[model samples]
Target chain A: MPGHGAAYFGKLAFGLVVMFAILAGLQAAPRRSRKIIIAFFTFLGGLYFALEFFYPAPSGENFLTGYQPLVAGLGAVIGSFAIGLGVFSLVQLHLRTLSRLRPGWGYSIVLLVSFVAMTVFGLMNEYSPNATVIPTVGGLWQSQNAHGMFRFLFSGGLSNLGSATFSIIAFYIASAAYRAFRLRSIEATLLMAAALIVMVGSVSFGTALTAGIHPKLTDGSENPWANLRIENIAQWLLMEVNTPAQRGILFGLTLGLLATSLRYWLSLERGAYFDKEL
Target chain B: MQHASENWWVSGLVVLLSLIIIGKVLSAQRGRVPFIRRIPGLNAIDEAVGRATEMGRPVMMVPGISGLDVVTLQALSIFSYVARAVARFGNKSIMATIDPIVTGVAEETLRDAYADAGRPELFEEGDVRYLTGQQFAFATGVAGILIREKVAASFLFGAFYAESLIFAEVGQQVGAIQVAGTTQTNQIPFLIAACDYVVIGDEFYAASAYLSRDPTLLGSIVGQDYCKLLLLGIILIGIISTSLLTLIHGGPVAHLLHTLVDFLKVK
Candidate 1:
């Protein structure tokens, strides 16, 4: 294990250096490693999950639960860096755009100004304890108000805008379905019929349609088939038919994903991760 | 919620099936094979890229909001093929990735694809850009790219969420030839609504086999279907036996069916 540790650290340093070097090379020199690092990571990620499941735990300690601390720390670090990278990229892009004064350059200027202001206020609130004293640039980092503004801007502005845009789907769906649901051909008719049935069947209206049908203790009097509860019929169709089709498709997809993953992880993917031919 | 013994049986079956598939594919690779069914959506990629090339426009590929998940990586695999085709035909591709890790991989994918096509000089690191981790920000950035660049064809595939509709709508508005696919059941409605060609659920996985028409891939696909058929057969038997027993009121068949169900009962 100690021997592996030395190799591991060496690999880590080598990998990190290679990462920066490759990033630099990407901009300067077009040369790249022949190896599939993405596939390597993908395989390692899969292995982590596989090991977590297949590897049994010893007595007195749980497997995943015990590793929570390590996992959480790593996740936090990764998450922070991701955020930082986004901010950095945004800043750089906007700054360049503003300097060049490209077409619609004003938008970039607005973006940069808003982003910088928000970030400054965010930092101020993080470090500031008191709001009354307007200290130097460093003091703003200590202001609670600044932090509150960042939360408000993020939660109120960006979050709301995103949600509102997403919610517009309701209108889009209604419009699209109306236009496309026209019965022009047999296939279209069949699709419409299926859609209508499935839509009704999944809702409470479908169940209510067959509320008259009762499950009687004595079935000698009348046949249950005569009732033909739509909801029950829908449930039958879903369980007997739709579910099977879905399961089949899901199973095929699962296998495809597995095979594709194996290909990538093993670096067998052609025309990917290397440009030897080129 | 199943018992450990039951889990073992399922696992064993999976391993057995996998081995059989591997063996079959290996054998087929060393020989000729049968014809595989064509997938229209995947077949359209070449024409889509060609149209973009003719117009002197870039092709945009959005791998959805999925990170390095299996579905995302599968999308990446398909993207590799698409990118190579684009590079070969002297077309440009811009991949707007939501995941940094995926962006990195996508960059490599494009790089390798260009290299494969003998056009490494055209590969641009800036093309494989990471937009944002947030779902909407990623969607907005991709939409921005589509509108600003006036990309000719957009390929949306992977695990999309709320932003699926937004992305699809933007692509639609751009008048770009859009081919969208996803396994996300809820988002399928949106994709089906806006995309010119939509790959629903498992159809996304069939891209490689469909596009390449490689026998090994096709054989594996068929093998997968065979497994699915077997599972379906078992479930059908279960349902039929259960229904018949229930209909018959009470008999030996009913008792036998009940016992069988109990014996195979899962949590």
Candidate 2:
């Protein structure tokens, strides 16, 4: 970004054209060979990351480490093209719905308008000089600039909608807890007891109830019985019990991820997606 | 993560485990596949598809909000299995993706799946949708689909964050039979509470192999179990050594253990 000029733009354009040509060629290639070719590239990419991680270096950085960012940047650029395809797909669907006056055509209108407004403002905000905060006499027109419009749509509209939608989850949680906390089985009872302890221990009332259970008793002797305090029980459950269970799950999760990666890196996964042809 | 050169002692364990996993995979391919217990969620997803087929409604799948990572890829594999089932029953399947590349890949995956089922026309581009790449926006869009289509079944797989509850709750509201799998431990509780079936932790990864019964995957899972045993052995050894040393309090063996542990630790 710092050294960009005519030469960089030219090279970028040339690289894009080369990439496009290669992709087109791959598309035109035989189906069986295409799978092999794709798998080969996938292996190369995975190998780079794998070695970068596993290979030891005297200076604490492997040879491939420095190229990691560049590779990631290239991947991001290619991914942006996929976004282009997604946009095309979305727009095509909405256009069909609007033309046919589908049942939910009104929602389609809202989507398209928002899409266009956000895209226009977002692009302008990115390319244009920073919009100066203009002192204005009009209240509603205070943020009429590209920055303001984008902020109005993004933070004010999208953010609020998202937050409100997410807020509904608290109610869902309450309902779910009501159903899950029933004393139906041993597991359920244990869960309920733990939940009750955690809930009570987290609050002031529970602590107040155990206020007399001081770490040191009135006679100035160590009070081992203080461990029975509600807060202490809750702290033990969270730190000693809950954390260990979470770690246990994480251990399995990490190993599972390792196995899945090996399956993909080796192209050993068998399915229509992976073994469509050869 | 420190470089292996800086922490070769720790890296040695990782490398050894990886070799075992690879070995198991190769061994499985040679007809020595290990057994994987039934993942109840697999049947649930299949049954959900069948229910949707009976109801004449589409089955919706949200493959998390991540990009083209291993998590999303596995989610896509499961989606492919669901698509194949849907195609077989002359039912429709919908996929809402939060990543553009995943949307493209999901489209191709479903197209191939439908073709495999000899129902190429059933694979509509409209069904494999590219919802907004934004997380909450995708949630809102997917919620709309769940409510409007009243899909009989919804499958939520992959790494979900805060929006996990939104999808499950909405599907529940629509009386959709939901099968959710996620490696996010925190999200698992919410999923378990709301969905009819939920896969937690590493079980999320096993969902694919259970559905496809691929020998390679079963072997990899067995290798993972072996690695788990290896970890348990190491942990037990560490606990015993530390306890004995604590009791003895200062000896050559304790000193050696301390040195070895310090060496393995990140500098």
All candidates: interface RMSD: 3.8, 1.6
For candidate 1, lDDT tens digit of each residue in A125-226?
Answer: 566623533334674564345556676677877789778766777766776677567797896687687677667877888767766776553645765663
* lDDT (tens digit, per residue) of candidate 2 on A65-151: 899889899799889789999999999989999999988999999999999988887776665525654456677555356787778
lDDT of 1 by residue, B60-135 (tens): 9998787766688778878988998898888889998877777666777778778878999988756777766678
The global C-alpha lDDT for each of the candidates, from Candidate 1 onward, is 0.70, 0.86
lDDT of 2 by residue, B113-220 (tens): 899889999888798889887788888899999988888999999989999988998899899999999988989888988899988888888877787778888888
Predicted structure with the largest lDDT when compared to the true one: 2
Best by TM-score: 2
- Candidates' DockQ values? 0.36, 0.70
- CAPRI-style grade of the A/B interface in model 1: acceptable
Specify the highest-DockQ model's number. Answer: 2
